[model samples]
Target: MHATTPPPSTWWSRNWKWCVPVLAALLLALFAAFVFGILMLVFGAMKSSEPYRHAMKQAQTDPAVTAALGAPIQAGWLVQGNFSSNGPDGEANLSIPLDGPKADGTLFVVAKKHAGEWRYETLAVNVDGGERIVLEDDAAMPLP
Candidate 1:
């Protein structure tokens, strides 16, 4: 008696179980990368804005801030706030984290743009477990 040979298994029948999970994992990784990239872009834009830069500069240079938090102050990456602009008209309210050798703090800023200029309404740094240091800018100084 001759015996019949079984047909070879198809590719999908052989590999589908492992392939499905791998494909799913790849898609999830790609989606996560996309979200992280978008967040970085938004935060980078905020960091480059006039209000953020101005506040950081003040915090770094101010004598009161340096004395409280120590020298060589640095800004943190996760800044929280809203910044919107339309030509020379805009508003910015931001809270930027700061760190130094002695302590940590949060820099708060509230500013408005008018006639291509940034006018700060509130700019101060609250040191952790310490007093808040208010930054004062000269009216005569130019705003970039």
Candidate 2:
């Protein structure tokens, strides 16, 4: 007598009646993750800087701005995220915030090492109709 293979058992099985709830759960998890990812990407790094924290709070509740980033931004502006060589050959970063619709939001960045110096290729990002946040003068204070 020939032996018959029982059947395939997996998420994509044809007889997946028992998998509706499971599939639904998995899909829900995936959707949640997608949403969280989008939120993080849109908000940029949620690092713990006192200024940044304050900015975020302001951004959320500050009446004027629906939300605020740790700092403001400039168009075609480039500055080091930290105090470094200041030679434009180190690390650079910028933060921008949007109140609504993620599709129209984007962050700008430019990092490069040139002549033993760091240079920013691009800095500052913006929304369709919004003002760029201004980075405090002491935002990039050198570390003693």
Candidate 3:
């Protein structure tokens, strides 16, 4: 005589036909959501930061970018051309709903790029739409 043993399942494998597809769908949805979230975050950062000239060029035509930044962008708006040295840079151009002010006055900015991110050695603000603030030292200045 011969004896045979039955396989055991932990409540999941036993429900293979149903569990598999459900798990696969859930996993697939999770992956899709994760990917979408990452994309939004990266794109949001890029959109919020207002990087460079090409982006500026795009901003001209993209109402969303324009509405996002509160103010019309112009060249020499970035830290390199605006500052005297390399360092952390931030443009509070877009708060949440809009970018910045458009009234006839200077745009004042007070910002800090979290430690280990970027250096803030030089800064400028076009107050009254004319002047741009700057630092007199090599070290980063407290946002003014």
Q: Name the top TM-score candidate.
A: 1
Give the 10-residue window scoring lowest on summed lDDT in candidate 3. 76-85
lDDT string for model 2 (1-144, tens) is: 999998777666865776788899999999999998886554444334233343334344433333433224221222224322335344435453333433233344434555664344443334455665332223334668
User: How close is every model to the real structure, measured as TM-score?
Assistant: 0.92, 0.27, 0.32
Name model 3 segments beyond 4 Å from true. Answer: 1-14, 52-86, 89-144
RMSD of each predicted structure? 2.8, 10.8, 12.7
Candidate 1: where are CA atoms >4 Å away? 140-144
lDDT (10s digit) by residue, model 3, range 68-98:
3346644332222121113543433221111
Predicted structure 2, TM vs. truth: 0.27
Candidate 1 residue pairs that clash: none
lDDT of 2 at 60: 40
Question: Candidate 2 at 17: error in angstroms?
Answer: 2.1
lDDT of each: 0.94, 0.44, 0.41
Ranking by lDDT: 1, 2, 3
Give the TM-score (vs. native) of candidate 3.
0.32
